[model samples]
Target: MTMSFGRFDLNLLRVFNAVMEERSVLRASQRICVSPTAVSHALARLRELLGDELFIRTSTGMQPTARSLAMAPLIREAWKSLEAAIDPPRFEPYKSNKRFTIAVSDFVTMVMVPDLLAQLRRDAPLVDLVIRPDSWIDLAEQMDLGQIDAAVGVFSEVPARFGSSSLFAYDDVLIASSSRRFGKLSLETFSHLSIAVVSLHGQHEGVVNGFVAERGLMRRSEMFDRAAFERTFTGSKRSPRVALSLPHFLALPSLLEGTDLTAIVPRPLAKLLVRSHPLSLYELPYQTGLEKVSILWPAWNAGKAPQDWLRAILIRAAEPLSANLFDFVRPARYASPTSQQEVAASA
Candidate 1:
């Protein structure tokens, strides 16, 4: 246990790291560009030196032992440090097969990822993307530990060493079925009808802002604005009724069909969804202002060209969404011919 650092071969440790990640000697050998026998030998040496089985091959896979699990983080951290020091930072999307992991909301996945995937196929065909869920996870901590490459959402309070860039601005819009009765929707008309709201946090919790404020990470949970909804009518005896609360946007379309339920959601999302469904969008009756969507990454990843390049691509994809975001999600005073045309097209 007290062997000198010089006695341990770093190469064997690298093999240990690879086996831990790949969980198979053959796969680890392929990753390290060595033979399976060499990989197995390295693992054996490491197990002997560390005085633990390190990994046990089971029916499922090569499962790391308790000690291996305990030491995995330190091993990964050490490997990362070595790569930072010695590996030349390079990313050639066309030729490189690097996998990037990003944390984003389901809304973004629906609206933006199509364009992103198309562009990636055209440009960086070999590059791969791993999409992770945005909320509930510690965004900053995950990025720091290399679990997440970038985070794209409404990041409210980014912790130190994390980077962010504004992607676009969107406003909350009221989604209603075109068939739903109302020649002209008024505060009185809206007050009595049941509404659907996307719950940011599921059954157990709720927050003022979309992101979990308790965790100190700034991701969005802009499902509904209670204050804005309440403020829509100043002297009304009753507030707007919320009949349903769902966890995600996927079910909104089905839930709104053939019903009087109206949902308040982001303008960009509403616009995209209405194109296929018989839905209509209206500006929030009250002035709630624009909500910003942003791209977030670790500052340590800033100087790396591949990371920066991908960030640039994502920002580019979001540009067109923001250009006309304010036009339709605006107050009634800003109604123009173009806005009318957009609304008509959506309806």
Candidate 2:
């Protein structure tokens, strides 16, 4: 039932977009400031014009069908263009109350958000922040669906179609209990020792895993660089032994306690861990190269005023960061060395 272009009204698309975002006809009506009856009428016209049951009412809510899911992103993009064309661009953070959602890894949540939140408090008091766990969100799809404003973490690769900014760069390092006889480790010791590799899947296992299970997509949570690790011992016969794998980093301090296992973690995390516990940080004998964490957003979001402001704030915050604060007995550059504590405290 493809209708002739002459009979179509663009307002029908707006109604459809609102419903898709809210996932409820009643809530969608409130979002658009219209009545539920009017929403139903517009939806009926849209269904007839599109020749598909766009949404099916169920016990849960207005569940979008296959056709609706397929068309939602396209329609959202069109509606955004329409709004931009008709409405003048203006965003005042102090006066405007808008919610911004960011998809981030546990690493960023632990290391970046503290400073970011403090800055937001002074600058955008009216704006609200929502943090989505990146390991559980199909970040690429979430950005496409307009569910997340931006993604922040170390990514191996981000699709070229999206917009991104490099926030900070970091390398991996080795962490172990201080009491261990091995004051410093050699390549041979590294290969024989039991290692704990952080697996994102292991962190968000049962109930938490279900957060993304309902959606048909997958995300890579762990940030280990196996390629770089193996490349260091290219010609050597000794291979590293992996004894255990856990998902989150917060527990590594306790897990490595009284055990012969050493955990590999980002140098920034190593900085924080050594401060709180009787732990030692050492340079990796194998060269797991630097990973640059970036803030990625949808192309549709590029140049949007409020989003741009927030992005700028993140870029500024990451300016003075360096992950290898504990690389030596005293930070090579930080003569005072206490500045390492200052950087760790920033996180």
lDDT of 1 at 81: 68
Each prediction's RMSD over C-alphas, in Å, is 4.5, 5.1
Compared with the true structure, all predictions reach lDDT values of 0.75, 0.73
lDDT of 1 by residue, 258-307 (tens): 78888888878887777767776665546666778889886767667788
Where does the lowest 10-residue lDDT sum fall in candidate 2? 331-340
In model 2, how many backbone clashes occur?
0
Best by lDDT: 1
Give the per-residue lDDT digits (tens) of candidate 2, residues 1-347: 54788967988998998888777999989999999999999999888888899999999889899899889888888888888888967988778789999988777777778778877888888889999887655677677778888888765445655788787777777777766645356778777777887766564553232122323223345557666776777898886777888767778889887778888888777777777776767667655666777888887777778789879878765655543332443343212222234445654
| TM-score against native, each model | 0.76, 0.83
